[model samples]
Target: MSTLPVLNNADMYHHYSDVQFRDGCSVIHEMLKPKRGESILDLGCGTGRLTMQLASLVGDSGRVVGVDPDSCRIAVANEQLKKMDDIPVTFQLGSIREALPLGPFDGIFSNYVFHWFERAERAEMMHQMYDSLKPGGRLTFVLETNQPQPNAIIRDIFRLTEPNLDEESASGMKMDVPSVWLQHCSDAGFLVELSEVFRTEKAGPNLDAILQFLKASIPNFQPIKLTDDGLHELDSRYKTGNGDEVAFSLTVLKVLARKPQES
Candidate 1:
């Protein structure tokens, strides 16, 4: 996985992600409906926290394969997996954009990881996922929708600092709308089981907390290098100030689709 991209702050990513991924795990379990002895894939499994939970759900007879592009994250995940010798789970260090060999899987579940790719990479990713699944397998994932989504403080700051560039030309990965993602799944021969976009509110106590969270997120998704000046500028405009706290709301997109049985 030498060619795969990784965040410099892998430790920060692991610490910050434990909470965000925990909530997504419940949703994944509800939608994926994992059963014992089923072979499942956890796409972009990060430090393998959610993957372990999935392993527990599937039990001893089952197998869970967790894949992530970041070698740093995979190393940590392997370290953690070493202690859980009883579970039938393995961590693989590779990008989902790359070809995978261990499936014909019963199901595939990913949370908050698909928006990083550009159009062509995403096309390949969807195709690879379709190829990896069994005849009647399912895939469920949660990611932000394109446009009108929240957590744009950095984007806004970049605009203010360098006003010439447009949003499309901005240096970040693009997120697609729900319809586009559904269409991609359909094109890849998957049936749309559940598809919806909804809103959620998330907040931080102050500017420092918010910046810390963004620092953890931005590096993993895009190669943007945020500076102290950029942070100050973003905080000046984006954070809502009250007596002693600040907050914001974010729009989220969720989809759960499945591959139909081949006849």
Candidate 2:
């Protein structure tokens, strides 16, 4: 699909991501390597599942804040935090479209959030992230990229149904090339020490599960408006390559950029 993946709305996403997002991002903890007493930011922290994990890792002396544009997501995250007796994390209903926390943080992390913006906005987001970090602070994230297999079966279904879905309309969802981000990091004064793409495949009981995951986790991944039957038909069409099982793969690009300590 040309559009970035996203849940139809925050609430629908809240329902699915509350359980799945944490498990899906299990790899990020090791990637983040959050240290005790360090200040970290979870950009686009959905429902605080990983936020709580980050909070625990930071220990009593550490600090972390989760930011998202959706108020409902922030609210849900806040509610989840309340269940805990103590946490070092906070949630804000904000976005990278605007400013971020004023900090020179030890690290900043985003899971599936960067692709939501266009290239220019992404550059702005990068500068803000670079400015928010400490001299040697790091920024790392996992986002979908159009590479090796920009397999967007969802968009194909949309095209088959709406023959007139032009490129302008389809372009709303992005499968950005990796070089775009690498350049953004450079423009934002970050030294990109690591960059790589990891391919993940998913096949499950049915298309419904995968559909919900895509709609929930991806940002603007699907176009608005479609009947239930239409979605089911789309799902069936996707399985043509895999028989009864629904199989698909997504390319996740992991980037680690560090602000120069001297600068």
Candidate 3:
């Protein structure tokens, strides 16, 4: 396990249990199209939502290894999979920057996880993925694009609270645009197969739902200290637009690459 302390792993998993999957995972699933009996690595497999789905596709003959930095999340994932009798699935607690236990996998799948690494470290992580995979192994990852919704009131509040926050601090990591990410993959010796950007709108049924979503999705926002008046103002603004139907946009970049046949 990594020595680095993870912040509120159990809270994170519990908060995101009902969170909806963006289009990025769907793109990865389409690109991967995991065949029976193929080995897969689900890097940063949070609560095993997508990991479980991948396991189903891989079936009993195939192997699925789900790894996360948070031990609590790993525990939750293991608990979730414990009831299943036939699927060949294993869960590990680790970060992508560290050495992985098993490797040369047939496919690597990640969703909404890579943006957590610093830009300087991202290339090395990609190289690590390259090293962990067999020649011609596929790598699919989904990352957030740094585009906020236009005329977004909630975002305005977030900006007001933390205007000078660094990208790494605000996001709990760094993120790059699609082009830069693709370049990083190419530099890591992966043959770029597919890359694209897509946007999605998330709707919270009520102010509480929106706040819960924010607390789960954005780590920096979780530990925020808001005064009573500030909280009231935020709630009032969120309730103004659509009677508690708060809508926010997310921009995501999806990439699918393959390790070189010789590397």
Candidate 4:
């Protein structure tokens, strides 16, 4: 989930995120094991779904800050925050590339986010995350691994449809391998606790639905504006007789690492 500061429709994206992604992140949360009274940062906490969950896990005494670059999603997150007065949850519009919300947090958690930062800046970003954490604080994140090759349909869509996107920008969307990311954590002086890759398939009602999900969630695709007719044509051309439903596989990497306590 790259930070789209100007999302086309935050509400629609939030809806699909809840339907497809929220449940899968439960395992990442378990790996985090946030405790009572701990202050945590939910990096790229789109619409605050998992951030709110972290608030519950950390309990009433704990504080959780959900930060994202998109003001639209942050607005949605704040709207939801009104109902959660009893919980110490806050939503902020910010980019990790700019600065994290004030923190020497006990833990930092992100989902499918780190890879979205500029490739050249990633090492510095990792170091910044490290600097924001308290001694012995943990950093846990899960992201889709870079496929050996981009999906043909998606690649074609970007290459053909997105007039504003260039070759380099499209290539930047690919995530790094698990080993490279694990090395990032190690380079940042984190004690690597876990690093593993897993696969999951996401199903949708139709190709159109899946495309909408991607358009809503992916920053690079924000420039793409397709009408109902266009989507129907897409479905007709690429659906491969899968009936009205579509499923796609994701190669995901989960990493948990901790800052060493002061000597």
Best by lDDT: 4
Worst 10 residues of 4 by lDDT: 148-157
- Which lDDT value does model 4 have at 171? 38
Candidate 4 stretches with Cα past 4 Å from truth are 1-6, 97-101, 149-168, 220-243
TM-score of each: 0.83, 0.81, 0.85, 0.83
TM-score of 2: 0.81
Runs with alpha carbons beyond 4 Å of true place in candidate 1:
1-5, 97-99, 149-154, 157-171, 220-246
Worst 10 residues of 3 by lDDT: 1-10
Question: Residue 208 CA error for candidate 1 (Å)?
Answer: 2.7
Candidate 1 lDDT, tens digit per residue, 1-263? 21233555566677766446755776666788899999989888888888998898889999999988778888888888898768989888786544368877888988877776667667667878888899888898877676574655545644644467664455354677778888888888889888777765555566555546556555533314456776666666556676335555545667778888887
Q: Give the TM-score of candidate 1.
A: 0.83
Sort all candidates by lDDT, best to worst. Answer: 4, 1, 3, 2
**Per-model C-alpha lDDT, please?**
0.72, 0.69, 0.71, 0.74
lDDT of 2 by residue, 1-263 (tens): 11123334566666655323653355456566889999988887867777787788889999988877667677888888888988788787676433254466788888777776665466667888888888989888887777755555545545644557653254355557888889989999999988887777655556665556656655444534556777676676667465566666667788888999972
lDDT minimum window of 10 residues, candidate 1? 1-10
Per-residue lDDT of model 4, residues 119-143, tens digit only: 6777787888899899999999888
Deviation in Å, model 1, residue 144 alpha carbon? 0.7
